[model samples]
Structures are given as structure tokens and as C-alpha cells.
Target chain A: MRFIDDFRNAEHVKALAGSIERRAAQAGRPLRFMEVCGGHTMAIHRFGLPQLLPESVELLSGPGCPVCVTPTTYIDRAIELGRDGALLTTFGDLYRVPGSERSVEGASAAGLLEALVVYSPRDALRAAQDSHDREVVFLAIGFETTAPTVAATLLEAKRLGLRNFRVLSGHKTMPRALRALLEAPEVAIDGFILPGHVCTITGARPFTFIPDEFGVPCCVTGFEPADILASIEKLTELCGPGRRPALENAYRRAVRPDGNEKALALLERVMVPVDAQWRGIGHIPGSGLDLGPQWLEFRVEPPDPERPSAEYSACRCGDVLRGLIKPAECSLFGEVCTPDSPVGPCMVSSEGSCAAHFKYGSQTFTAGLAEIAENGKGY
Target chain B: MTEKTIKLGHGSGGSLTRALIEETLLRYFDSPLLAGLPDSAKVQLQGVPAAFTTDTYVVDPLFFPGGDIGKLAVYGTVNDLAVVGAIPRFISCALIIEEGLPQSDLRTILSSMRQAADHAGTEVVTGDTKVVPRGKADSIFINTAGIGAFRPESALPDAEMKAGDVVLVSGPIGDHGAAVLSAREGLNLDSAILSDCAPVTEVAQAILAGARRTSFLRDVTRGGLVTILNEAVGGAPLGLLLREQDIPVRPGVRSICELLGLDPFYLACEGRVAAVIDAESAPIVVEAVRRTPAGQDATIIGEATAEYAGEIVIETAFGTHRLVQMLSGEQLPRIC
Candidate 1:
């Protein structure tokens, strides 16, 4: 609480916000920026960053929320295993995310499956070791930042030779998603505020493509609003519609290009790139990582479509993921798709745009989103 | 190592001191009066009876994320009374000061305590102070008690939660835990992740105002919501059903929880509150709690019923279901 208290000098945030607004006016006609870290998305939402920013400078959330991007079939697969009588294990966020007709929480609450919510992969591995009778499957979902842990887990499982232990690998690579965002014709992003955590793992090199090929200003930023503003300044100042890639480290306090080599190496040994299926975006060709042959025992497959499933057809989560609309833009947003009764994956994940827009983005958050969706255009 | 034997310091009026009371003595001996024990003993009088309790905080890092020992001590007692249907009125304060704590830091903490107390609409009533040798204690330990007017419940262990009784949480989980984790370890992300450490009596009072057929109410602390769901109905006939997507957790908290390998369900949240009420009243109470700042993110996490015959299970996001058992050991120590 003390550390936060020190940071709460709100005047500083105001000063920073003012500076950003001022800087944006002189910088150009309009500036577009996106934060790749889910944490940054949350912080921006928590602090009301959008409302404070100048009208010309737009803050759009990218594919930062992991649960939002998680395909529905994966959840169905997880639910299937839970129904097939395996003890499902995952972080709490994954527990609430719906696959098709239900979530792991529903299965656990309904007594159809055993959901072991754990704090770490160590705990999942420990559960696999301690409970010989139960089938423990770790529902792995994250970016390259968290990819190494799964590597460590699989290697540990291999060492322990725990037969009951498996990982439903829904884990993704950050760079791939970023590339998909840039390549999309519908999206016209001017600058990128790269992910801090993911960069810490893959390093700034992975983002070199955004600068070299796409010619978009790429600045790896810290989580703070000031950090974001500072990164935005670098991005806008450096980004002059040129056909050259630029690599910048706005979060220099922590990130380096090579990143944690040990972590990267650990991931390299245990995993390899494979064609992954995105829920709303469809398959983005090698956008996901699959366990290597040695780790096949821990492999996960897409869930069966035949199982009992439920979905509120009106949820426009597909639009939200592709940067076509915000969460409130969905017709079912707060009415049918409140946090309690999520209609789509974005609504299901707490960090999703729908959740953010619904929870904090507006006096009536959905109004702006609906208008944007109605316009059928991207900024 | 069973944490069986108690030391002399266990009675030292610090956090571990209370842990001794809760973990060792209270575990084997919990009754209405004993269970009701808070910062101070409450004796009901005619006009407006109030509940009160005091706790001494000795967390290793005196302050982290959203609040500190002083703020936690204030909100803890206030929330305890509020959960039991009381309007927190005033609080008594005392400090067991470590001999060499910086005066400025102490002033800062005291000011924060005042601000938090003021924010909660409770005034500091009476107090005491004690100083000990430097190594004798952590940097600082705050002991505070709050009193609140008890609403005329006019009920008992009454109408035990039915099979369809809904379980509700005041707001998102793991704010305090993630905030503390980041602050304690100096893990910098893009933005500041602060603790959700504050009182919720005003919101709790609102939920209680709209009386419904309720069996029990408890704030998920120490063990998180998972622990509360496990203990909701002591009897063998009660069943607790939870829809995974219904539960809310801040995305950052979830990601950090994933990164650190922690469970937000088991993570500590000072501002989050939970209660077992009639299924119909959950949304009503959620709406009521939403009126307060702390309860803005309130949601109905699950329901309690006479189904499982006596166990807690959570469905995974992947669609499978499993049991959510009580934490046998500490997940993250000194996170309050």
C-alpha cells in the first residue's frame, strides 16, 4: 500500500496527461496508439486514460487480453476432458472463460468435472505428482513471456515422468499476433506501444518486423500512463510515414533485445511454431506454438463440436478481436452480455474490451462502441 | 513444522500473534461468541447495537500497493462488522512501534490511516501506544478496532441456504494480492497495479438493507473466495455451484497470477466481500453494492445449494469441472 500511496500523486498523472494532449496537437492531425500488454490495457481502463486523452490522440487496445483471443474450441476441449473425467487445472481467469456451452467453473460447480485452480505450473505438476489417480491437465494460456514456464513444466513432467500430467497448450506468441494486427487491411494503426512482458522474453528483436517492413513506429513501453505517453511521444515523433522499420525501447528500465536468454532457450527446446486457430480471427497461419515431439504427451487438441454448447448469437466478439469495434459496440454488451452472463469470449475474459468498456469505459460505455460498429469502420 | 507449538511472541499482539489465535487455538475452538470475536468485544444495548473487533498488523513490508498495516487494520475490522450487518461508527487505535521506524514514514502511514478512515466515514475514537526494541518487531504494527451499529437481523442460523442459494462477491478478486506482489518485488509493468484495500461496510450495509432469505455472509480473506465457497455451508447436504465465467478478476491480476503461478481465487483482496443469499437477491444485492466505489465490479460468482452433499468444486475455463479444496498451506505469506 505504501508503494501505491507514493505513486498516487495524481497531480503527476494529470501533468503527464496534459503534456500528452499538448504534444499530440503539435505532432500531427491524428495519432493512433495501441498497448500490447493486457496489464497496460487494465491500467489504462482503471485510470480512465481514454477519457483524459485529447480527442485526436486515440488509445486503442490491441490483442492484449489472452483470454479474449483464446478460441472457443479449446475451452470445449478442456470441458470435454473435464467431462471425460479428467481433473482440469488452470489459473482462475481460464476457469471462468466459456468454451462452447459452459465454462470449467460451471463444470466444477455442476459436479461434471474437477477444476483444480492453481497459482503456478509448479502446483499443477505437484498436483499431478501427489494425486496419482486424477488426470491433471494444465490449461496453459499466455504469450512468449509465459511460454518458458510451460517449457519448464513439460521438462519437469518429463523428468518426473508423470503420466497423469498434461498441458492444454493454448499458449501464443506475441509477435505473431502483432504481425496479424499489422497485416490486416481493415486496420490502419499508426504507432505501436509494444508489450513489456512479452518483450522481456523474446526481446526487442522480435518486434523488428514492425519497423523494418511495416514502417510503423514501434516503441516497447512500460505500464504507467507517463510511460505510455513517453512511448507515444517517441512513436509519433519518430513515425513520419516512412518505409523503414524502427526499433525503440520505451521501457528501457526493464527490457532488452536478447531478453532473458535462459528463458528463451528453455522455450526453444520444449516448443515450436505451429499453425494455430484464432477464435474470432480464424487461423492466422503459424500464429501459435505447439509442444515439440518430445512433449507430445502434453499436447492438447481442439474440443469436439458435438458436445452440449450455448452461445448468445448476438455478441459481436469477432469484431472486437479484429479491432473492428470496442466491447460496448456489441449489441448484447451490458444487457445480455454483462460480466455475469458473457455472450462471447471478449465478454468472458475480464481483460477483454467488452469487460473494460462495460466495467469502466463509459457513463454508458456501449454507446460509443455501438456507434463505431454501426459505422463499420476502423480508425 | 506442523506449526503446532506456539511461541511467546504468538501472544505479542502482532499478525503472527493473531495467526496463533486463528490457526492454533481458534481452529479447534470456534463458537458463535468466539467466532464473533473481533477487535473488541461487543455488548448489544437498546438504541443501536454495534459490532467491534481489533487486529494488530505486522506484515513484513509495512506498506505495499493499495494500503498498509494501518489501512488494513482499519478496513479489516470495519468490514468484519459490516459483513455481519452493522454500520461501522468509530474506531480505537493503538500502535506497537518498532523503536527505529522513520518518523516521516510513520507520519505518512498515520496520514494514510486517517485518509482511509475518513474515506470509510469512521473517526478515530480512543487509542494507546507502545515502543519496543528494533529487532523485537517488524518496522511497525498497528492495532485498531471498529464499532458499528448492528441492524436488527431478526434471524438465526436460520433457513439454511437452500440448494439454489446464490453466492456473490462484492467485486473483482486479487487486487490486493497482485498489487502487493508487484510492489513487494518491484515488478514494473506498463501501469501501476494498486491494491483493492478499503472498507466495504457502506456497500455491505446496502446489500443487507434489502433483506432476503439469507443463510450466511463472509468476506473472503486469507484463503480467498475458493476457501469461502468450501466453508459456506458446514452441513453435508449443502451444494455450491459456480459458473466459471461469472467470477471477475482484473486482467492484470489474472496475468500476474499466471506469471507468478498464483490463483486469484486464493489471492487476498481487502475490498472484495462475499455472501450467500437467495439466488434472486444476488443481482439485487449486487446492484446495491454497485452503488459504492468498492463494489462497482461486484458480481454473482456462484450459488450454494444442497447438492454436492459437502464439497466445493470449480469449473475450469476449458469446460471441465473439479473440486476447489481448502488451502493446506500458505500460498503467499504476509499478503493482507
Candidate 2:
């Protein structure tokens, strides 16, 4: 708890909150800050940072959750492989997430799929090694933080000559996705709290375009309460009237400006950037990473053309992901779409905006709204 | 409708398990006694009120850092009976052993079970054993059913929880879960973590003695504390408000949870007991619980609230509040 306890210190948090308030007051106008990582979304809600921030500073949840951004088609295809007599493995979060028609759980319940939750790609390899008769397909879905491990796993599989293993890669690159969001006309993001873990891999250089091109301040911050608050403070000062937009690294301890060279090299050797389809957001060019040609045989095939595509017409996940609307604004938010029976990935993924709002933000917001109605202020 | 096959989540003892009980199992066996869904079934047997509870243990690896499946099987049933304010007296064990299991391993398991029963002061008077083919079952599976005499003078009803009641948890959460997970996954952490698997009978007795009214007592087992609270307030005109900072979680367990991307609140604890007591008597009950061996880490974690009825709200250390939902599906380790 060396790093963790220090970040959650009550005295430090209070002092930071006071400084953030002062910075927000100096800005005068309302400021919108978006943290583009599922980890950040969860941390912000877990620490209840929104209530501590000034009313003029609004935090918007962007498409940061890898599981939330993964398209339903990917889940559908993974389930299809499981039904076709292949052993499927994925991180636990994907087990209950709904595809167009069925989830991995639903498919397993129907006795058509044999799926297991593995903590890492190595575990998936071990499962394949343990079962010689069945082919094991690992559903690889994550950002840069996890893709390097998957790359290493692929390399090891090749070195070990393990032909029974394959990967269904849904791995995405965060920089391009962030670029897409910044370019979106509907999104009114004032500044960005860049993903700290991803920045640790690809480094702060990838995010320079955000400030230089779009004139939006960006801060690479850790997931701790203090890191988030300090990043918000930096963004507030940078967003001041006369200050030039800049990219600052508030999470300097973990993230270097150049990032991990070995991880970047490993990604370069095993994978290439491709046009990837995000679940709610449409396809962004060169946003997804696919296994290199040497690993193509290990790639799970696409879904059959005859299978009907499923869509949640009632869900506003796309709007929510684009920061066009808050999760509560969605019509199916808490009523029909809940954590138990999620109508959208936003409600299903722990990092998704809807899940964070439903679990932490909504009730707190309601309580704050009630207090404001009575006393004219939330805090 | 086509019958849906069982999934692992149905056995996770979380929201899915509750749904299975209420939606499928309870539908077939509808009765007032079954409707209560207490940890143990309360029944009058030959003019004597008794608490009867049964539990099955299918833990992997058979043995863990602090205890094995045998001890878990024994203490699990005894604790279930004890939480109902009963004096656990008799236990019946029925084990399903696989054919290829080693004889020496069987002896070790049985010996551990005997020691655990002795420690809890309960008698395993009757037992049954069956051997299945190698592929049919795991190495071994244990089923224990316990019976305890319920004294009317000290009866603690499960449905007696009211608004403003105090919630107390005996000892830290997630020790058993983290220990088992680490042992299974081979996580060689810097510190050694052990399972908190023991009978909570003494803690329960002390709590009942000190509290003016003990509303309910639940062993935080497979679904951990949050699930138990959710079940405790199901459909009731009350909610639970917990302070995140007050909840006791060991540093090692916290580190493991952080590394694995899991929540300690949803992790399992075999020995801990979550109790609801009258607000005024919380201090006395906490003191009483502290005197017991199992309740050395006892503290008031939260209180029953009228706001957000049937929901559990946690006031985070950062001065924000969030809802603690029941564990849905398995507590799978997150990738990111």
C-alpha cells in the first residue's frame, strides 16, 4: 500500500480539492473535463470526486472501457466459435456481456459453447496446452496496456509450436480513439484526462497532437484520487483564457515521455494498426491492432454471414460514449437496462459510463440535487 | 420454454444464486418456511424448536494456507446454525470421493474434519461415504447438515431488521477469498495470507448476549458482505449505509485485490459474521464481540437507513456516495 495509501490521504485530498476549487474560480466560465479511460471512470466514481469538484467544473465520461467499446459482433463471433466445438476463453467481464442475441453465458447455458474466464493470455495458452483435442481461442480485448502481453503470448505460442491456440483480437489503440473524439463536432470537450496506463506504454508523445492540433489541454494522470484531482487542477489552469493548450504528465512516476520501448517494439513486431469497429462509436481508421500475417492462422474467423446482426435500438450507448449525453439521459438507463440485465455495454462493463453512474453517480447526483434544491448548492 | 442449463454463476452465492433460488428453486417448493430464506430453516420438531441447515463444500486444491475443505464443510454448517441463535449440537457429514483419490489424503481430510468439529464443540455423530468413478467427480466433495436447538428466549429472527439498526462485521473481509485465490493462482506475494475459516458460534453468542435485540446474523461466505446485506434488506423498507473507510480489510488482502482488479467487499470470508443490532446497543455489542476470539477485529461498519430502501449505499472516503450492488456472476479478475 506504499503508493496507494499516500494517494488516498485525507489531508492531501482536502488540500487538493481546495486548490482545484481556486483554479476553477479563476477560469470563471464552466469547464468540461473528460477522462478517457475506464480505470479513470471507475476511480472518479469510487472516490466520489465529482461531488468534491466545483459546480462549474463538469467531468464527462469518454469511451475508455475496452470491454465497453468492443462491438457486439466480436462477442457474437466469440460465442459462435464456442458453439462450433472450440474452447473459448476471455477475461471475466465479457462472460455476462450481451451480444446481439446472446452472451457467452447464454451460449454456455444453451450447451452450445464451452467457455472459461482466464486472467491472462498465458492462462489461455495453458488451457490450450492442457486440452489437446480442443482448439482454444483467446478473446483479446483491451488497449495498449494489455496488447503487449497478448503479443508476447502469440510469440510464445509460435515458439512452442502450439498450433491448437488462436486469438480473436479486439485490441484498440487509445491515441486514434482520442483523436476521433476530439474531432467529433458534437463533443464539446474542454480538456482531457488521458489514460495513465496506456500512456505508460506508448508514452506522452502520442497525446501531443491533442493540444497542438485541437488546442485542448491534456493531462496524463494516474488512477488514484489525488492523481485525478491534481490532473483536473492542471487542466483547469491550462484552460484559462490566456494560457496555451498543453500536454502535461501529472503521473510522471509511472509514465515517461517516451514510454516503454520494449512494449512498443513487441507491439510493432507482432501486430499492425487496422480500422477497428468500436461498439457504440463507428469504425476509426488505424485504431485497432490486428495480429501480423505470421499469426493469421491463429486468428479466429469472422462470424457467418447468414447470422442476423442484433442491435439494442432503445439504448443510447453511442451517444453516451461520444459524450453527447450523460448516462442518466439515456431512456433505458436504470429502468430496463441495469447491471443485472444490461441493454448496452455501457451498463455491462464496470468501467462503462452507465455502470459507473448507476453504481455511484446517480444516487449521489440525486442526493446532491435534492440538497441543492433545498440549500442552493451541492457542497 | 426450454430449460436453461446451469452456469457457474448459479453456484457463486451472489445475485445469480439468489435468482436461481427465488426464480427456479423457490417456485417449485413454495412454503412460508422456504419464503423466509433464512440461513437455516426453523422448524418445530416434536415440540422442540430447531434450526436445520445444510452446506456443501467443493473447494479446489482440497487444502489451502490456513484450512482445508473438510474444516470449511464443518464450520460452514455450524456457523449457519449458530447465526440463527441456536446452539449447534449435531452434524452429519456425507462425502463424495473419487475412485483415484489417495487413501492418505482421505485420512488427512477426515482427521481435519474431526479436529474442526471438536474445536467447534459439535458432534459429527452420523456420516455417509460414496465413491464415484474417476471422471465423475472432483477429488472429493463434502456435504454437511447440522441441527441446533433454538431456545425461544434467545431467538433471533432474520426478518426483524428495522430502520436505524447498526451493522457490524466480525474481523476483516476477503482473507479467505484472497488466500484461496493466491494459492490456486500461485501468486507469490511478499506477505503470507491465510484463510479466516473458523466457527463463529462464540462471536454470535456474545453478540446476542450484549445486544438488546439481534435482528439477524449472516456468515459472510461465498458472496461476501455486500451480498449478505443486499439479501438482508431485500424488499424491506430499509437500506444500509456503510462508510468505506471504517470497513476493515487487511493490507495484504487489499494489495491482492488491487493487483487482481477485484473488490474486497464482494470477496468471500468464511469466518466473519455480519450482524444487525439495535443502534443504542451497538457499542456494548462491539465490545462483547471483541472479547471473543473470532471477533477480535469487530467494528460498526454501517447502519440501516430509510434512504434508498432495499439498497446499500457506501460513503466513500472522498466524500462521495455510491450504491453497492450484489455480486453479479462470478468475481472474475479484470484484464484492465
Candidate 3:
């Protein structure tokens, strides 16, 4: 608790909160800041940061949850691989995610497929090594923070000449998605709180475009109460009238301007950028990662296009992810799309904004009900 | 449409498990005792109040740091009975052994069970065993059923729980979960954490003997403290407000949870007990609990509240609050 307890100091958080309130008052307008990372989303809600910030300072969620953004087609492909007698492996976030037809968890539970949840890509590689007679396909999905590990695992597989190991990549880059969000007609985010973990790999340099081109102040943020509050304070200070938009690094403790070079090099050697489809958001060109030519032998085939995919037109995840509305504002947020029977990936993935809202921020919606019940009109 | 089959989450002791019980199992077994679904069933035998509980251990590796499956089986059942205000006196063990299991491993497990039973002051009055083919079972699976006489002076009824009641935890949590996970061969890190798989009988007994009014008591096990607390306020028009800083968690467990993107609140603990007592007697109960060896870390974690009914809200260090929902499924590691 050395580093953790220190960052969560109440005194520091209170000071930062007071500073943010002062800065927002000086700005003389309602400030809308978007935190473009699932970790930030969870941390903000987990610590109930909104209660600390002034009502004028509204925080919006962006397309930062990797599992939420992963296209259902990718999951369909993994299920196909499992159905073809291959052992499917993936992160637990993707286990219950409803694909086009059925999720990997559903397929496995029905005895139609064999699947396992691996904490890391190397665990999937180990499964491949352990099961020599069968093919092991890792349902690779994540952002840059997780891609390097998958890249390293592929390199290791190549070094050992493991033939049965395969990967279906759904990895995506973050900075480009931010660019798309800014360019969207409906989104009016005044500033951005960058993802700390992804920035640790890609560094703060990739996100400079948000401020330099879009004139929105951005800060690379950490996932602590004080860290987030400090970032908010910094972004608010920079957003003052007559102040030029700039990028800041409040998470310098773990991130660098240049990022982890070794990981960048790993991505360069074994992976390449490609056009990929985001689940709620539509296609974003050159926003995805795939195995490079040298590692193509380890790649799994694309999903079958003919597979019947369920349409979730009623899900307002796209609007929620785009910062146009809060999760509670979505009609199907609680009663219709609870975590147990999620109507969209946003409700299924733990880091998704809806899941975070439902789990940690539902007091806003339920407080009224509780008040009514306390008035003696029993629920 | 998703197929209806027994998924792994059904055994996770979370929402899916509750659904399986309410939607399926309860349909066949409709008795009120089973319907209430307390850790142990309360009944009267020969006009004497008693508690009965059973648990099965299928923890992989069979053995882990600081404890093994055998000890877990005995302690798990005894703690269930103990928390229900009963004096654990008799337990029965049943084993389903894989054919290829080594004799030494079996001996080690059985001997640990015997030692655990003796330490808890309970007797294995009757038992059964069966050998299955190699693939039929894991290395070994142990099931234990216990019986205990109700302590008339310390009968903490569920209906007695109300707003303003204080909640106290016996010790740090998540050690058992972290230790078992570390014992597996993956995510490559050498951990020194040990499973807190000892008996919570002392802690439970201490609280009961000290508290002027004890309303509810539960052994924090499979679903951890959050799940237990959620169950405490499930149907009641009450909520719990927990101080995040007050919850005791070991540094090692916290580090492991951080690395894996897991919440320590949802992690399992085998040797901890959470009790809901009258607000006036909380300090006295904490003092009494600290007198026990296993309860040295005891502290008041939270208190029931009339606001935010049917929810558990945790107040953070920054004076902000959030709702702590019952875990929908297993606490899986997140992908960054």
C-alpha cells in the first residue's frame, strides 16, 4: 500500500478538488472532459470522483473499453475455431461477451466448444505447448497495452517452432479512435484524460494531435483518485480563456513522452496496423493491429461472413461511447440491459461505461426510489 | 438464443449460482429451510434447536501454501455451523478419490482433515469413500457435513438485522484466493502469500460471547465479504455503508490484485467472519474479538443504513461514495 495509499491521500485529493472548482469557475462555462480509457472510467466511478467535482465539470466516457469495442465478428471467428476442434483461449472479459450468435462462454457451456481464459498471451502459448495434438487459437483482443505481450508470445512461438499455436488479433490503437471521436458531429468534448496504461506503451507523443490539431487540452492520466483529480485540475487550468490548448503528462510516474521503446519495437517486428471494425462505433481505418508477414503463419483466418450476427440496434452503446449521453440516460441501461443479461457489449465488459455506471454509479438513479420507499410507500 | 447448460459461472457462487438455485434447484427442492439458503439450515431435533451444513472442496492442486483441501473441507463446514450460533460437535466426511491418486497424497490430506477436526473440537463421527476411474474425478474431492447444537444465548436471527447495525470483519481477506491462484503455473511470478484457511471458530465464538446484541454472522468464504453483505441486505429495505480505508487487506494480496486487474473486495477468504451487531456494543465486541488470536485484525468495516436501501455503498478516502453491487459472475482479470 506504499504507492497506492500515498496517491489516494484525502488531503491531496481535497486540494485538487478545490483547485478544479476554482478553475471551472474561472472558465465561466460548463466543462465537458472525456476520459478515453476504461481504467480511468472504472477508477473515476469506483472512487465516486463525480461527487468530488463541481456539477459544472461533467466527465464523459469514450471508446476506451477494449472488450466493448471489439467487434462481434471477432468473437464469432473464435467460436468457429473452437467448433472446428481447436482449443479457444481469451481474456475473461471476452468470455461472456455475446458475439454474433453466441459468446465463447455460451459455446463452451453448451458443450459445443472448448475454451479457456488466459491472463496473458504467454498462458495461451503454454496451452499450445501443453496440447500438442490439437491447435490452440488465442482470441487476441486488447489495446496497445496488451498487444506487445501477444507480439512477444508470437516471437517465442516462432523461436520454438510451435506449429499448433495461432492467434486471431483484435488489437486496436487508441489515439486514432480519439481523433475519430473529435471529428464526429455530435461529440463536443472540451478536453481529454488519456489512458495511462496505453500511454505507457505508446507514450504521450501519439496523443499530442488532440490538442495540437483539435484545440482540446489533453492530459495523460493515471488510475488513482488523486491522479485523476490532478489531471482534471491540469486540464481545467489549461482550458482557461486565452490559454492555448496543450498536452500534459500528470502520469509521469509510470509513463514517458517516448513510451516503452522495446514494446514499440516488438509491435513493429511482429504486428502491423490494419483497418478494423469497432463494435459499437463503426469502422475506423488503420486503427487495428494484425500479425506481420513474418508472423502470418501463426494467424487464424477471418470470421465467416455468413454467420448469423444478431442486430443490437436498440442498444445506445454507440451514443454512450461517443460521449453524447450518460449510461443512465440510455433507455435500456438498468432494467432492460443489466450485467447478467447484457443487451450490448457495454453492459457485459466490466470496464465498459454502462457496467461501471450500473455497478458503482447507480445511486443517481436508485436514490430516488430509495427516497420514495422511505416515505412509507413500500417498494 | 443462448443454450441453457451448466456453465462454470454456475459454480462461481455469484449471480449465476443464485439463478441456478432459484430457477432450477429450488424448483425440485422446495422446502422452506432450503429456500432461505442460509450457510447452515436451522431445525429442531428432539425438540432441541440445531444447525446443519455441508460443503465440498474441489480446489485444484489439492494442496497449496498454508493449507490443503482436507483442512479446507473440515474448517469450511465447521465455520458455517459456528457462524450460525451453533456449537460444532459432529461432522461427517465423504471422499471421491481418483484411481491414480498417490497413497502419500491421500494420507497427507486425510491426516490434515483429522488434525483440523481435532483443532476445531469436532469429531468425524461417520464417513464414506469411493474410488472412481482416472478421469471421473480430480485428484480427490472431499465433502463434509456438520451438525451443531444451537447456542441459546447467542442466537443471531436474520430478522434482527436493521439499520444502524455495525459490521465487523475478523481479519484481512483475499489471502486464500491469491495463494491458490499463485500455486497454479501461469502469469509467472513467485508469490509469498499464504492461504488463510484456518478455522474461524475462535473469532465467531469471541464475537458471540462479547456482543450485547448480535443480529447476523457469516463466514466469509467462496464469494468473499461483499457477496455475503449483499445477501445480508438482499430483500431487506436496508443498505450498508463501508469505509474503503477501513477494510483490512494484506499488501501482498493487494499487489497481486493490482497486477491482475482484480478487486480484492470480491476475492475469497476462508478464515474470516463478518458479524452484524448493535451499534452500542461494536467497540466492546471489537475489543473482545481482538482478544482471540485469529481476531487481532478485527475492526468495524461498515454499518447498515436506511438510505440507499437494498444496496451496499462504500465510502472512499476522499469522502466520496459508490455502490457495491453483488458480483454478476466470477471476478475475471481485465484486459488493458
lDDT of 2 by residue, A3-100 (tens): 89999988899889999899888888999999889999998887788878888998988889999988888898898888888999989888888887
Docking class of 2: medium
lDDT of 3 by residue, A65-158 (tens): 9999887888878888899999998899899999878889999988989998988899899999999979999988889999999999999999
Candidate with better TM-score, 1 vs 3: 3
Fnat of candidates, each listed = 0.00, 0.69, 0.86
**iRMS of each prediction in angstroms?**
17.2, 1.9, 1.6
Question: Cα deviation in Å at residue B111, candidate 1?
Answer: 36
Please estimate how well model 3 matches the true structure, expressed as its whole-model Cα lDDT: 0.86
Q: Write the per-residue lDDT of candidate 2 for residues B15-34, one digit (tens) a residue.
A: 77888898888889987876
TM values, all candidates: 0.57, 0.95, 0.96
Cα lDDT computed for each candidate against the true fold: 0.70, 0.87, 0.86
| Docking outcome class, model 1 | incorrect
lDDT of 1: 0.70
Provide the interface RMSD of candidate 1 in angstroms, 1 decimal place.
17.2
| Candidate scoring better on DockQ of 1 and 3 | 3
- Candidate numbers sorted by TM-score from highest down: 3, 2, 1
Q: Which residue segments of model 1 deviate by more than 4 Å? A: A1-12, A239-245, A302-312, A362-379, B1-336
TM-score of predicted model 2?
0.95
